[model samples]
Target: MRTSTTMPPLQALRAFEAVGRLLSFRRAGEELLITQSAVSHHIKQLEEMLGVRLFIRKAKSIELTPEGAAYLERTVEAFRIIAGATSEMRRQTARQRVRVSVLPSFAANWLVSRLADFMLKHPEIEVELEPTLRLEDFASDYADLAIRFGTGRWEGVRAEWLMNEEMSPVVSPALYDDGTRFAEPKELLLQTLLESWNPVGWELWLGEVGVDIRRARVLQLTDYNIVLQAALNGQGVAIGRMHMVRDHLAAGRLLQPFPQIVRSEKIAYWLVMPQNRRLRPGAEAFASWLKEEAASPPSPVC
Candidate 1:
């Protein structure tokens, strides 16, 4: 006789669950990838453990007894809960795949440029980039990780400081080759100030340079990419986030107008992940690689 504290074997529980559902030990064996004898053994053991006749056996069929019906109901419900939890965990840790939620501007200007190298190095792992302005809730069934640009005050997530933000003015070299020229900080008033939807704005930068924020003429653009495009085309001088424009600056597509650079007071880049859930193996690999990439100096523009 089994004690109240003692639980039946897992094999017996599985066999009972299947046999009670299908009403046939033979059919249950087939579903469980075992022989009919093994299924019978498990059922006999399970019935003896509980000291109850769980099934009524006929010559050609079997049916659950009243006691078995009640037990099976509870067993099936327990199985359902177990299966659901297992599925949710597996979905997050899907094999060899890492999904990331990031801002469109960062994805296009920063990540896209360096993604190819990661792919070449880790062909076995796959990375999916989901670009959106919305912040990710890692507890949800969405991205495995997130790249956030902020002061890292978000709740219920772990934020690793990724990089610092540098602010400076960038313009096309053509802008100065006889077109629009700014000799000093005060001369920028003569040019159309290209602005973007960013945490740090031209007004803040202007104030730092001793220029009256109200006196600055601004042309608002939709996003940072557009702002850079307008500056590259000599449309106006745009504030450059150094990490985003490093490649462009190195390639001579854009040039910094001033020697002074200011680090943002309240914002920078961070790698975010769930505080409670463990990262998938693939996500762990990607995260380690990403940290290494962030720590190392960036490659020179070719």
Candidate 2:
């Protein structure tokens, strides 16, 4: 029989794991719904039981000692295995769910519209969508998969190429009506330019066409979706991402005024998953579906 003296306290181990993962006793306490003093006491007791120092205290912050880092890796993996087993047992008795983390703009303009089809096809699997600008940690239970806009390179994850990013000037039909054409790129300097989080698209395109952006009237917005909305309202011209605006352009809701298309060198969409981690069946299905969807041809430009 296992004796109490031979086994480390589960509470202390839990506290230590949380502190090691977050590198802050206060944060661990907050997450565990305990007091900072309690968290420190648990860590101290854990270190004493293990006969090793686990953290290096600093003036403002703390860091895991070398021994703590090694122990953390094993502890985290153990927790992951336990969580996986629990999830598997639950899945065996209930519908499987896949948690997907995605960028807000992509979720709003691209993925959400097609989700109904996925749902119809895979009735056994449920999907939870988490849309945020912040990246998800695959090591945690944050998400099963992530759709990220990047260069297909992230540490500890396998990034499958989704699609290349292309941008061009788009305007509402009202702005393009009356047979009004700006023959010269410089003529656009007189029109309102809608700006998103990063105004690099407009800067790049204007520079490529030798147009000075200093003369252009700019309306800055917080999100790409909002910028597109403004453009749809005929308020200004927006640098539209091809993938996001293809349907709108095809439907005559938006029009590409300029023929020049700019390709982004540093950014593209990617399907990301944890490296060497076995994906749940639900996640695998979603990934396969996403690949098929990406391979399909775009809507014809109207």
**Residues 1-302 of candidate 2: C-alpha lDDT, one tens digit per residue:** 56488667878889989999888989999999999999999989988888999999999999988999999898889889989999988867688899999988899999999999999999888999998766676877779999988667678788899887788888898876755577878878878899776687788788888888877888888778889899999888888888999889888899887789888765579998988888888899999999898888877676
Pairing residues by index, what is the TM-score of model 2?
0.63
What's the lDDT for residue 63 in model 2?
93
TM-score of each: 0.67, 0.63
* Local lDDT at 4 for model 2: 85
Q: After superposition, how far is residue 68 of candidate 1 from its true place, in Å?
A: 20
Clash count, one per candidate: 0, 0
Query: What lDDT would each prediction earn against the true structure?
Result: 0.85, 0.86
Among all windows of 10 consecutive residues in model 1, the one with the lowest summed lDDT is 196-205
TM-score of 1: 0.67
Per-residue error for 5 in candidate 1, Å, reads 37
